[model samples]
Target: MQQGGNPNDIFIKINALLEEAKPRFSEECCIYKVPNNIRKLNEDAYTPQVVSIGPFHHANQNLQKMEDQKRLYCRQFIERSETKNLESLVSCVQEMEEEVRSCYSDDIKLSKEEHVMLILVDSCFILEFLLRFYFLVTRGDDSILLPEQLLVHIRNDLLLVENQVPFFVLDKLYYLSFPSTLNGEDLHNHPPLLSLTCYILPGFMISEDNFVLLSVSSDVDFGRIAHFVDLTRKLLLKSSKLFQLSTSDCSREAQVTHIYSASELNELGVKFEVNKNTECLLDITLSGHTLRIPFIRVHDWTELVLRNLLAFEQCHCIHESYLTDYTLFLDFLINTDKDVDLLIKKGIIENWLGDSNAVAKMFNGLAANTVTPDFNVQYSNIFKDLNAFCAHPWNKKVATLKRDYCNTPWKTVASIAAIFLLILTIIQTIFSILQVVH
Candidate 1:
C-alpha cells in the first residue's frame, strides 16, 4: 500500500483492466491460428509456402513476392469483371469490413483501411485464380496453367486454416466479377463459386469418381461454409454416410481403449478391403470379419492437407470432430510401417509418398495435441466392434496357430506330417500289446 493513492481508485483501475481483458471470441469467428502445440510438430504443414491469403501471414517477408501477383490479379479481375471499376470491388469489401474482421479469432493489428484492402486484394486474387483454373479445365485454356507447380502451391495455400477469407466474401466478389451476362453464354454460365472451388481443388477429393459428386452436390449449403477449408470439409461430409448410421447400442460415454494394428488384426483373421462404392474418404466401415477403408492416395500434399484439416477441427469444430475422428481412427489402425504395408497390400492406401514408414509416421503424428471426446466419438462403435472381434477366443486361437506353426506352407506341412507319425506309432503300439495278450 503506497500511501498516495486511495485503495478504491486502485481497485477501480484494476476493474477497468479486467473489463478490457475479457474474451472477445465471436460466434462468427472461424479462422484461427493453429494451436502452438500442433504447429510445433510441423510448422510448414500449416503455413503457406507460396502465398498468404489473409492477415495471418500477410506480413511475412518471404511471401511478399506474391504481392505483385495478387495486385496483377486484382487488376485483371477488375478489367475482365466488367464491373464499374475497382471501386465496386472495394465498396463490396468495405461494406463487409466488420463482419470480415469478426471472422478472425485473433485481433488483426492492421488499420481499418489496411484490413479492408488486404481482404479485397486477397479475395480478388483467389477469384481470378479459380476462374483461370476453371477456364483451363473447361475451355482448354492453357494460359494460366503453365508452370503447374506454382498453381499447385497456390491451391494448397488457399486451403490452410489460417490463410483464409470468409467464403461469402469470395461469393460476393464472384457474382460481381461475372454478372448474369458478360461474354460467351456457355462459359458465362459457369458453375457457382463452391462448385468451381471443388473443381480447382481436385487433390482433396476422395476419388476421381467423387469429383463430379462434389462439384454437383446440391446438399452442401453454401451459407454454412466458413471458408475454403470448411467448404472442402462440408463437401466431404455431404458425400459420407458415416454418422448418419444409427449407433443406438453404443454408449455415448464409450471411449476407445485400444484397437489392434492392421497386421495384428490380419493375424486375427480380420480382412482388409477397399470400399470402392463410396467417394467419401471418411466412410470407412467394418463388416463382420472385413474392414473396408476407402482408398487414400498419400502424396506430398496429403500430410499438409490432413494437418490443416486436423488443426481446423481442433480449433473451430471440436464438437463435430469428423476429420479428427477419422484421422485418429487411422492412427489407431496404423501403429507401424508394417500396418502401412498391410493397407498398401489391401489397396487401401496408395502410398505415393514412396516410403511406407513415412506414411505411418505421418498418420501417427497427426493426432498430436488433438482431443477426441471420450463420449460420442464418431468411431466409438467401430472401435468397440473391432476390439470385440479380436477378443473372441476363436480368433485368438486362430491367430496363435497362424503365428506358431501354420504361417508358412512348409511349416504347416511339417506339422501335419509330425501329427500323422504320432498317430501311426500309437496304433502300432496298441496292435503289439493286443498280439502279446493273445
Candidate 2:
C-alpha cells in the first residue's frame, strides 16, 4: 500500500496467493502408500486379496467379490447393534472429513457421499468380521465365513497396511454401534477390538494363549492409532515392554562391523541355547560363552507377517527400530541352511516350513528388502560385549576343544578317560625311565 499507488494491484496479488490452498495432510505423515520398491518384492503381502477396507483397493475387481458379503455383515451389524440413526455415523465423519482424509497419505478421489459410505460399510464389516471370526475360531460355531480358507485370506487382508480404516473413525463407529454401559463389573476390562485383533493375527503375536491375559483396557485411549497396521504394531510393543527405547540422549552403537551367522559363531566355540525368559523376544544373552535366543516359530506366514512389520517400520515407527533391528539381527544370524539347522537343534527356531533351507531363504530374503540401520544402534552394548567375548583367546580355545572333543556326552566321557589314562601312562613311563637310569 505504501509503495503501490493502486489498491487493485495489491488486491490482485492477494487473490493470486489465496488461489493455491494448502492441504490438511502430507504423505508419510500418518498412513502412507506402500513404497513401490518394497511392494515389488512381495506384492501379495501388500495387496488385499479377499477384501479391501480403505480407499486404496476398495474398488478392485478381485475385492469387489467381497462387497455383497460386506453388505451382509453390515445388515447383521445393524441388527446386532440396533443402531437408531445411520445418518449420525455419516454426519460424524462428514464433520471431520478433511481431518479424516488427512489420515491417508494418498488423495482419496471419492465424493463426500461415496467416502462416507466407504467408512460406514468398511467399519461395519470390520466390526462384524472381528466378532464373528473370533467366535468361529474360539467356539467352532456357525459357518458365517465358510470354507475356512476364505477366512485365512480375509484375516491376512485385515493386516495389510493398505486396507485400513482410521482407528478414530472405527472407535467412534464402534461406540456408536455399541453404546457404553456402566455395570457393576469393571468398564476398563477387555475390549472386543483388542480380542478380535489378537485372534486375527496370531502369528505376529508372542503370547501363546490368545493375548487374553493382555493388560490393555477400553477405558484407556491409545493415542492416534493410524489404522489396523499401527494397532498391530502397538499390540506387539505393548506385550514386550522391554522394547521401549532407552532414555539415553546420545546414540551409542557398537564397534561391530558384522555379526557372524549362528553356525559361524558355533565354530568359534559359542554355545547355542533357547532363552526361557518371558521378557522381550530379542532379549538375548552372550555371557558364559553361550548365546541364548528366544523361541521364534518359523512358518510360511512368518515371512508375510515379518514383511508387513518391515514395511511398517520403513513407512512408520521410524524413531524406534525394534522390528527392523530384530529382523536384521535374524538375517545376520541365518545366512544359510546350516544356520537354520543350528537354530533348530538349539530349540531357538521352530521351523514349520518343512525344511531348514526355506527358513534360511526367508530370513535371507527379508534382510534383502529391509533397511539395516547402523550396526550398533540398539544392540551397541550387547554387540560390544559380544565382540569382547568373541575376541578372547581362552574362549576360542575352549570353544574349539568343546566342539572337537566334547560334541556329545559319550565323546566327552571317552575323551576325558583317554586323557586321564594317557597322563597316568606318561607318569609310569617317566618313573620306569628314572629307575632304569639309576
Candidate 3:
C-alpha cells in the first residue's frame, strides 16, 4: 500500500501531508496535538498555515474535511472564489489588520502597511487557542468558524509591527526566570495574569461562620473581583444542589463534596488560565475540599462577573432564598442607576423585605424574653472559620440555635411529646384522688 493511501490510514495521511508542507513553510509550521471529538481541532491545526500561505490553501485537507462534513457550508464561497472573489478576501484581511493596531499604544507606531502586518501576527498568535476553545466549548453545533482565514488575518495583524518580534517569544523567555510570586502562583508577565489567577481560587464566605481562604496573595484586580462574585454565585447554586442530592442519599456526602470540588474547577476556567493551582487540598474537619488562588495581576472585571452568573445557573446547590438574595446583590452591583424604585420596577431585583421583616420579629421576641443564649456552637461548620461573622456575641447565639435546630429536629419533637404525656398523667391521677375522697 502507498504510505498514506489506505482507508485505515487517515491519521497517517494527515501526518504525511504535514511533513510535505513543513518544508514549504519551514519557519512557521509546528506540530500540534488536538482533540478528535471537537470539530475545531482540524481548523485549529490549520490556522498557523494561513498566516504564511495566503488564502490559496483553502483546499488543504482540514478545510476540505470541514466542507465535507457540511460544518461550514462554504461550497458556494469555494465555487465563487475559484472564479471571481480573490480581491474581497484580500481587502477583508487588510481591514482586519487595521482593527488590531487599535489595541496597542499610538505614540511610537509604525507606518500603516507595517502596522497591519504586525497586528495580524499578534492577533493570530493570541487568538488561535482562544477562538478554537470558544468554538469547541461554547458553540460547536452548526459550525461557522473560518479558522484558516482567521489565522491569516490575525497573522497579518501581528506582522503590522514587524520590527517588534512576536510577544510569545519574549513571554516564554522571561516567564520562567521571573521571580516566583507563589511557588506555583505566577500566571503571566502581562496585565491580565493576576486577574486570571484570582478566578482560580476566588474567596468565599461559608455558611454564616466560616471564611475559606481561597488564596494567599491579595493584590486583586477587576478580573478577580468579577471572578470572585461569579464563583460565589456558582458555589451557592452547587451547594443547593448538594443539599437536594443529600436528601436522597445521605451516604453521598463525600460524592457531593467531590462534585463541588470538580464543578468548581470546571466552571471557573481557572484551569485554562492558571492550570498549576487547580489541584484541591483536603479539609478534614468539614469533610470538604479547598483550592487556593493567588491574586497578583488583574483586569477584565465585567467578563469575570458575567462568567460567574453563567456558572451560578449551572450549580446544583442553588436555593430559592440564596438565589433571590444573590440576584438582588448582582443587580445592585451591575446596575448603573442608584434608584431602588427603578430596580424594583425593572423586576430585576426581588425585595428581601419580607424575609428581613420576619427575622426582625423573631429577634424582637428574643430580646423581650431577656434570656441569655449559648455563645458558642457551629451549625454547619461551613462558616465557623469566618471570624467576621462568628466573633459577634449575637452571632454566637444564632449559630448555636441554628446548629441545634438543624441537627436534631426529630429529637426536639420527641421531647415535646414526652412533656405533654407527663402533664396528662398527672391530671388523671388528681381526678381519681378526688373521686376516692367523695
Predicted model with the maximum lDDT: 1
Tens-digit lDDT string for candidate 3 (92-121):
446654433332222224667655443333
Report the lDDT tens digits of candidate 1 across residue range 105-170.
999999999999999999988887887777764323333357779878888898899999999898
Candidate 2 lDDT by residue in tens digits, 365-395 = 7756555544434465655556677788997
| Every model's TM-score | 0.90, 0.83, 0.22
The Cα local distance difference test for each model comes to 0.81, 0.71, 0.31
Ranking by TM-score: 1, 2, 3
Better of 2 and 3 by lDDT: 2
Worst 10-residue lDDT window, candidate 1: 243-252
* Better structure of 1 and 2 per TM-score: 1
Give me the overall lDDT of model 2: 0.71
Alpha-carbon deviation at 25 in model 1, angstroms = 1.7
Q: Which stretches of candidate 1 lie over 4 Å from their true place?
A: 1-4, 137-144, 181-189, 202-204, 214-217, 244-253, 375-378, 423-438
